[model samples]
Target chain A: MTLRELWFRLTYPLRQRRIARDLREEMSLHVELRAQELLSRGDVPDATDASLAARRQFGNATRIEGAARDAWGWHWLDGFRQDLRYVLRQLAHAPLFAVITMATIAVGIAVNAAAFTFYDAIVLKPLSVRDPGSVVRVVQDARITAPDVLPFSAYDALRKQARTLASVVVTTPPQAFATILPGRSPDEPSIAAARFVSADFAPALGVGAAIGRWFGPDEDAAAVIDYGFWTRSLNADPTVIGRRMIVGGRSLTIVGVAPEQFAECTSRKPSYPRNVPHSHPP
Target chain B: MSQQTLAAVEREPIPPGTLDMLILKTLARTGSEQLHGFEIAETIRERSRSVLQVEEGSLYPALQRMLVKGWIAGEWGHTPERRRARYYRITAAGKRQLERELESYKRVSAAVALIIQSA
Candidate 1:
């Protein structure tokens, strides 16, 4: 390309027309400079004649524009800002409608916030897993298709086949009705909840035992209860880790206690002693 | 009386044609070197001192718009005066647009002037 064409192509992507105007002005200056140089050397009447001659060598402006647009993609942000400003103006005009819409949005936001807070506290937050983004729950194919919980054999198979997962832990939660020693009435039974989980349960979520070590692998007779469990049921004993308690017709040694914030899964499932016969054969 | 119409006039939208041209020329003169939002606005103001005046609020929106269009690039960095600022640089494509626009605008304006004078 010639010098003028080359300059046009170089500045094509610059969206500001003023920049183009400045460039054109700069080019015109250069043309005048060259023309004056020719005139001083006794070439012609003035720079205008020299510029006309220069223009003959310089290609058509239309071709240069086409090439510039083809080379540099369209700039659309200016139009978008224009549209946004227009919308903001329109929204500002109708105060009553805007207030009503905002009120509806505010109500919706509050409800969502409350529900999420409850979910994060009770269901989602307690898992002490390493990089929760990498963790996946092992649900049965049948459960995914329908809404039923996984059976014992399916859970076992899922654990065996999904080797890509970091770890697999299961929980069978149960609700218990127990009598507390010190109450307003002094002989009232309190409602409590508990879930039975594998030894790797706490380790899967990266949560450590608040007191002693959690039940070691292959130690089914031991149980790691929550801090609330010891405080409310066992009277907050300092040395409760070695103590045994009868829960759901089975005696379980309190091997360790979890922090108050940590909790195991509480969803309905088989093998939950009070709920159903879902335990696998030992 | 609702002040909405008055507010709209007070904060009129920057015409797309003008904004695009301003960004292109700003980048072309400054080169694709990194420039903060304030510096870019200042540069445009100084360059068009005789013709036009650009406000900071309008400049920022135009800069943002340019970034979204990918015509120019920007990044957060410390200014020479030691303030946190967003610096912008012109792309190769922006330079080409400046030249094309200058040619088209001059031609169109000249033609319009000729028509007006003849009539």
Candidate 2:
């Protein structure tokens, strides 16, 4: 369960009593006034018989109490239930009209839901990382294209100059390449893609390996294999770290394996890429 | 009560979903005077010329619903007859609802009458 749902469930018990008491008092007041009304009418001389007759004429107290309780429990939902019943009755009188109206409403809701889901997935959902709230993407406003990419030099300058940022890492656009395992045949290369990042990429993203350690500044020639790549190519071998692999005609040591959900960028890239630094760290 | 008196006093039951509107109309007519449950029922009965008696069962439930919906507000007060009672007053929402319901009812009844007269 989500933390919010758990918290609500934990706190709900404290408020339930107050809600029940308020409902009881409201219903009790209604019954009391009703009895008084019956007594005032003076049809029956005895107060007890008059009150009883009034209640009987009013109908089942328990059933009305239950209905009122349901309203209190979920007010909007109860109203919706009543409205739905009314609509169904009307629809029963005119089946064709009901069909047409229901179809129109269904299509409208489906289209709206689909659009909202797409927008939520692409724009609203936060990145899957620790402290995602603190992570901010740097975009530069170029004269040609608004909010264009920041140059590596500018990024480096920001990394050095900015005091507010705990850490900043630059990620280069993904490039397609071929991988060749060291000691394997040269003709047996596997096609892959890679995204070059700065030394603090993993730390800045606040992610750690599921197995083995992340690359340090000195490990410029190291590569981190994502869980998907590790499972698909290396068969998820526990001892796959320290192995050497060649990508883009460069040999690198496998230092770590990223968690399954970790994607280097939030872009809609079909293939996950191994994260490596651009050239070597300064 | 005699059979003729009983027959005269009794009328068709009020249709469902219209009780709240009728109660709201009754309260609105009272202009600033908060009416208790009995008084509201009596006002509706008298206005309808004793043809519509608001029973305790339906009246109280409708009142509760209206209170929950924020259409009307109620408070504990003493009746002019010196009895402790819960008096309900029409809120702005209740007034608006009464006007809307009254308009719709008029239109619907007119249409229904047209069909019935033709038949």
Candidate 3:
């Protein structure tokens, strides 16, 4: 027999209580029969001596008892852990192939887990979103625009149609550029990005700002920078909420800082051109 | 009894021809009782005296082949003391085969002996 098969056979009795009980009974019967045969042959021995010899031939009695106890406590976990260690040692002996195989398997497992997590969160998990089934993306016909830069007029038409979309909202992400404003840094120009969005955009996504007030649904020429920007750029000024700022060469009042999670898109949803449907129409 | 038992323990050489045939005859004469493997080897060695000595290794393989060919059947049981053991018994086909082989050997031996006497 192979070493693995022998190991399995030797351990099976100890691993299972029912099998161990049966084996103990069978072994006792065998020893009893032999002892009786010896007695008939005129060999006189005490009952205790016969029992001791029978147990000794098998191995130490206490070892078997300990094995049975440990089986209940760990329940094959110890054996599986040992097997894993042995497998690792064997893999290490073949270093080059082991490395390649491990790398390949790790990449495959990571990608599969990430995709499943996203699918579970976005598609399977119930959302408090409005018209969730009807919510869809209406984008550029040519299928090529920045993900944070959907056109306002296209969104307006989709919202008006009523037959196509329940509602349409446009999101304009922050555009970063070199800022020359005095006292912005150590008397030197530095990079800053700003965003502009329609008021309904925050409510459409069903999230709200944490501090101060959010913009009204029909309010135009308004914006909300990220909380990180508000703290670092405006020096945490409480009165900064109603201040005007230049974004994309257009004037917009800072209504409030956006909430933490609303900072950026964690996933890269591909940008589509101006005339093509990027996603199903909402 | 001691001499016979001691002699039984020793190996004896056999005549060159018809080794397997002799084994078949021995099993046939014994009424095919359930016998331990070592006992079978010892019996054949003692009864044949200097004429035959079947190696224990040869017996096992031959018995296995016989089992496959349907000449004998093997079964696991106890010895008289109930120790785990295997026993072999000849089948009807094996008895028939023994009869044919014995006759062929008798004819050949007789013919060879007559030619040697004349020469």
**Which candidate has the highest lDDT of all?**
2
Off by over 4 Å in 1: A1-113, A119-126, A141-148, A160-162, A175-190, A228-237, A264-282, B1-119
CAPRI category for model 2: incorrect
Which has the greatest TM-score?
2
Per-residue error for A90 in candidate 3, Å, reads 7.8
Sorted by TM-score (best first), the order is 2, 3, 1
Question: Candidates 1 and 3: which is better by TM-score?
Answer: 3
Best by DockQ: 2
Regions of model 3 farther than 4 Å from truth: A1-22, A41-131, A140-156, A159-167, A172-174, A177-189, A203-206, A217-221, A228-239, A248-252, A264-282, B1-119
Clashing pairs in 2: none
Q: Can you give the lDDT of residue B15 in candidate 2?
A: 75
What is the alpha-carbon lDDT of model 1 when measured against the actual structure? 0.56
- Please give, for residues A1-282, the per-residue lDDT of candidate 2 as tens digits: 436434534454466565456545545555556666656765567678766765666677667655654433454665798999998899999999989999999999999999988787667777767888998878876765556456668787888899999987776666678888545787999887777777777877888887887788766678887777778877888787888888888888888888766643355332333444555332
Residue B112, model 2: lDDT of 97
lDDT per residue (tens digit) for residues A79-188 in model 1: 67789999788879998888898999999999999998878765776345446677766554674564335556776776678768767666653556352322224345
The value of fnat for model 2 is: 0.32
Note the DockQ of each predicted structure: 0.02, 0.15, 0.03
